[model samples]
Target: MSALKLAIVGGASTYTPELIDGFARLRDTLPIGELVLIDPAADRLELIAALARRIFARQGHHATVTTTTDTTTGVHDADAVLLQLRVGGQAARDKDETWPLECGCVGQETTGAGGLAKALRTVPVVLDIAERVRAANPHAWIVDFTNPVGIVTRALQSAGHKAVGLCNVAIGFQRKFATHLGVDPELVRLDHVGLNHLTWERGVTLLDTPDATTGTEVLPRLLTEHGQAIAADLHLPLPVIQRLGVVPSYYLRYFYQHDQVVKELQDKGSRAAEVAAIEKQLLELYADPALDTKPELLGQRGGAFYSEAAVQLIASLLGTDHRTTVQVVNTRNDGILPFLPDDAVIEVPATVDATGVRPLPQRPLEPLYAGLIASVTAYEHLALDAALHGGRDRVFDALLAHPLIGQIDLADHLTDRLLAHNRHHLNWA
Candidate 1:
């Protein structure tokens, strides 16, 4: 097979090296001839590109790494363009993680009022980039890794762009389950269902092999054996997982234990602040000519196993792997979740291949999970609307619809604070 060309739109991100590491290590899965790192931050872009090239060289991979600030130029003729954007960067995220505390809500980048703020700031920019990618290479697939992925991906697909959203949550669970089962990670398949971030692993199947179609259901055994360990990892009690007979995404804590989480968030510095500090250290490390490998500190920067998830998704989408694989992705519901509208973007296990992603059929969800999923799905629709056509009223409506901020008074306060904190990023604010 001829080598493919790939692009990373937010290549200046500290996350770039993790991706580079994946491309270098998984060269057989997805061969690339050229990689264009596109970002407006020229200085950081060059630093990341230089490190990326060194990483490729260290791994004996011959891919040429390039950098550009122009989206069209960077994405030209690309087979796949990965979006890892942060519209207003960490400074905006710091506010997203803080201001919502005033309303006694969980302040997070990908949920609640803070997530709505991020969507409003991010959707327009991503749409513009997607248009440029479409203009340059209409056949190229857009793999979105941006946060509040459900909404952003909905925007991309609603605009009729060929796009899918990828997240590490499912893959992270797979790895953990694999370790517990003492099997290879590839042998573990999760019945991961629900919207992005708001998902639960209803089942864990131990496949006969990496490519096997049949497997033994091991969720009951997993809960019986590693329940405490798993619960500790999620920071939720074992009873919660046992009571539901499923492991909820760690993000669910923002909803399940909203008040407690708010107090914890209020008492601590924002995750954005912590990541900003890590990025600083990472950049310093990247600047080292001798540093060809991703530093240890990068592990703590989050998005664990993202590179593997991304490479697998891109490889499958481009047909480079030539094998049908089931991976959890955010794509159009299209009736996968009977409770959601067909157009709503959902994060669930799906079969990915060159033809595109088709969400796997799922068993019915009980009202406990279904109710929240329906509520958040509604908020996501309104959030996309507010992102597409910016206005204070639309923003308030989205916040009001969010399960975490359903109260009128809290939504009002959050709406004003969100607008105030993000006015510079929102054109119509």
Candidate 2:
């Protein structure tokens, strides 16, 4: 087999180095050569190229590195492409979270106004990259690692690209739940279903065990007892356990918002101001001319986070010896659950390889939980249609279909307000 060529977009999201580190860490286990890095910004690309070369040189491995501002040049002949491009990254995320708070609406990372903002900015860019991949390397598998992942991934898929969105939050919550219950996350079976940032934990238990207690199970008891409070104490943006109960937190903004908590923040000052301050600090660090002098500050910092786990999962599927401990993956439903949609994005255990992803089968959600999941899938499909066709009515129907949005006569109100407020920003307009 030839050495796999990996292409990474958005070379400056701070995720670049970690992914390089992930591939490099597995160099002894799996052969990866010729990393191609692409971004429109030259300075960031230079920094990333320098860092990657230094790391490769240290291991006495000769890795061909390609840096380009052009997508076609970078992605052509690649085996896999990881899309990490952010329309604006943290600066935009803060705006998304702060804008709704300013309007007395629930500002969030993945729902309502903030999500709408991100979708508008993200759709065009993601599609552009997807199209380039199609034109350049028709066989490459594209893994999208962007926020509002359900929306973006759906867009790429509907546009007829082989793509799946990736988020580490689910894996994080699963491990925490396992720790709380004194069980291995791998052994626990999860009947999880929902939209990207908003999913429900319809059911959970040991994968193979003699029938025992129900609510008396350790996982459920732990969640019911200290889940919400722990989330609060941690200041976690999403209430993983509280919103989905036994399910992993799929960006909780879709189901619940602690209005009081947000109100308190507003009462004190502006959340956007806080974001600006953080941005200033990051920008200063990024702009410092002396960063090259400090070895520690030259590349991605902090030990391995879950984002790298996605790559390891892919390596496992490819039959590499570099297997990961745990991974959260999206795979097609092949009757594992009779109730859930066959094409719905599922959170399940998977093994990956050059052949493709293989998801383990699990039980179905309860009827009521399945219905909730259906509603979210409906929104995902419709929103994807709207993004692809530029149809206002489809977008309207998606808002109408959402349980929370539909309950509040949100279709007309949200559509009109967004049409008027974001006419200039929206790609559809």
Candidate 3:
């Protein structure tokens, strides 16, 4: 087989080295001859490229590390393209996180009115990049790890691009649960279902285990044996998990307790600021040529297990992995959830391969979960529309449809704040 090439669209990000390390660690799974880091910021790209090279060298791999500011040049002839671009950067994210607080809403990058703002700014930019990737290498797979993943992935697919959205949330949980079960993560198969960032692990089956048989449901054991720990992870009370008999994704806190989250955000300040500080520190660390491994501080920056997830998905997509892999990805519903529209992008466990992704059949979801999924699907529809066509009414409708901002007054306030913070990015604004 010929050596493969991969491109990272937002290669200047400090997070790029973590991915580079993954490529080195999982070298057998996804071999590469050249790795291109594409970014507009030449300064950060230079630093990131140096660190990426050092990481591969430390691992004794010869993947060529290259940097480019031109999208077409960077992605040309690549086998896979990874999109992690942050349109308008952290300065913009600061506004997205702070303005929503004034409206008494959780200022978030991917879950509320703030998320809507990010979608508006991000979708068009990402679509253009996808187009460039398509032109450069039509066969190249687009792996998106961008924020507002469902919206971004849906946009790429809607434009007839070959794309799959990857997130670390499900894998992070899989690893966490595996540690609790005293088993390897590969043996854990999570019944992870829902839209990106919004999901639940209803059933966990151990594929290979002595204490339990394959396909055995162990959600109860996870909750009962490690209820407090699980609850702490999601920030939900033990009583909630006990009553539901399932583990909700951490993002659920924003929906299950919207007002409380708003109060907390108001007091705690924005997460972006904290991440900004962390990124600053990481970049400084990345500049140190001696530092070849991913720092422990990267854990605090979130996206745990991102490298592993990306490697697994890319390996499956490239047909290099021999066995069929079941994993969570953000892709079209196609009846995966009977309640959602067929075109709505959903994050659920699917059979991944070079041919394409096929969502597994799931048992009917309880109304408690199904109802919100439906409502959120509706909100996502409006959110995409709002992102594709910039208008105050479209923004208003999306916010109103969101369960977190259903009230007319709140939606109105949120729409204004979103547009105001993101006007420069929105062409129609």
Q: Which candidate is the best by TM-score?
A: 1
| Candidate 2 Cα errors over 4 Å, as ranges | 55-62, 88-91, 174-193, 200-250, 261-280, 283-304, 317-326, 333-340, 407-413, 420-422, 425-427
How many residue pairs of model 1 clash at the backbone?
Answer: 0
Which tens-of-lDDT digit does each residue in 1-429 have in candidate 2? 557788889875454656666566667555677889999888778776776766666666677877999998999988778887767666666666665565455666566655665776778888989899999888888887776787787677667787766766565555666666677665554555555665555555664442222222355665676666546634554355555455435345335455664676467654445655644444455454444322444232322344455566555544554443334565554565566566656555554555666665555565655676677777766666666666567667766775556734556666665565456657567
Candidate 2 Cα deviation (angstroms), residue 241: 6.2
Per residue, candidate 3 scores C-alpha lDDT tens digits across 1-429 of 567899999999878877988899999998889999999999999999998888899999998999999999999999999999999998888888889889788889998888988899899999999999899889999999999999999999989999999999999999999999998888898899888988999899987542233567899988889999999878898998899998999999998888898899898988889999999999989888799888989888888889999999998998877657788999989887888888899999898888888888889999998999899889888998988887899999999999888999999988877877787788999
* lDDT winner between candidates 1 and 2: 1
Better of 1 and 3 by lDDT: 1
Clash statistics: count for each candidate: 0, 6, 0
lDDT of 1 by residue, 1-429 (tens): 799999999999999999999999999999999999999999999999999999999999999999999998999999999999999899999999998887788889999988998999999999999999999999999999998899999999999999999999999999999999999999999999999999999999999988898899999999999999999999998997998999999999998999989988989979999999999999999999999999989999999999999999999999999999999999999998887899999999899999999999999998999999999999999999999998889998999999888988888899899989998888897
lDDT of each candidate versus the true structure: 0.94, 0.63, 0.90
Instruction: Sort the candidates on lDDT, descending order.
Output: 1, 3, 2
Candidate 1, superposed: residue stretches over 4 Å from native:
none
lDDT of 2: 0.63
Better of 2 and 3 by lDDT: 3
